[model samples]
Target: MTVLEIEYKTLLNQDEFNRLESRLAHVKPITQTNYYFDTSDFVLKAHRMSLRIRTFSDKAELTLKIPQEVGNVEHNQTLLLPEAKEAIKTAILPNGEIKTLLVQKGIPLEELLVLGHLTTIRRESQTSIGLLALDYNQYAGLKDYELELEVLDAEKGKIDFDNFLEQHNIDFKYAKSKVARFTSTLKKNDQ
Candidate 1:
């Protein structure tokens, strides 16, 4: 399946996450682990793309995200346990639309390699403007929180998000994708 993901992402500290979670106690949270992949030289990152195998409780999915004008265009395919293991072990892009898209973009399948992993505890609630998500993520012995408003309508979503922030008195700032942030950390540690 393909989707156009239109969302605004902002960084949050532990205190903010705690307060937000308390206020959103009615929403149940789900935990998922994302194993990300890229070439040793970071070909996917250079292309502003990402590939990952996301494992939930009973299912796993391989997803590819490519930069788009409005938002990131995502292509996802379901994967069985064996396929997910083999793909991670060999750093091979999964066979399907995601693989085809990568190949079309001139990213050699063989060069793709496992980058790192991150786990997120996510809670979501539906709002008039869009879906609101509070994500607490951990990777590489580091932890952080993020707020995302996945908007169906960009203009309205923006207006709603701004008002939401103002109403909550949140002065948080936006950041790049989780993959990008983890990749940067990996690079810094390597040096």
Candidate 2:
């Protein structure tokens, strides 16, 4: 898939934020939460991306996965194929414009809830994003919260990311896997 997005690197402080708020005029800021889930052995995922176009901001994300799992194999490994649940994304353009897309699935919500076993729940917002994916019974057994920022660029995203972290004195470990792995850690911890 073609990944297309823009990004910005700027820190927001209280005093500067007041000016930003004043500049916003009548536009109201938004924040909300979303609960997501997948299945056993890499069946689910959540993907998000952000962009900046001149004076606007755009973001997109997708979740809901089902992986084919192989069980009872000892001392070896399993090859898994995971199906991405269509794709749902949201974005904002250079003029402070916003857009969103939702996946089409006719399955009854009640049935999906029953079949998927509710392995993940995520609460994402403008300032941050949160995720928890695990076996239903173990969902309440663990609590993990983390902060992250993704700067999209053909080149410079890594450099810019490092600079932002260094300037803020934010200590971070290189992400060893995809961000989706963080969302899947909840389920992995169940074992």
Q: Compose the digit string of candidate 1's lDDT tens values, residues 1-191.
A: 99999998789877778889999999989998899998888888889888899988877899999888898888889998778878888887666888888889999788877888999999999888789999999999998899999987878888888888888878858778998888888988999
**Clash number for each model:** 0, 7
Scored by lDDT, the top model is 1
Q: What is the alpha-carbon lDDT of model 2 when measured against the actual structure?
A: 0.29
Q: Using Cα atoms with residue i matched to residue i, what is each candidate's TM-score against the true structure?
A: 0.94, 0.33
Per-candidate Cα lDDT values, in order, are: 0.87, 0.29
Runs in model 1 lying further than 4 Å from the true structure? none
Which stretches in model 2 have alpha-carbon errors above 4 Å? 1-31, 40-145, 175-190
Backbone collision tally, model 2: 7
Give me candidate 1's TM-score against the actual structure: 0.94
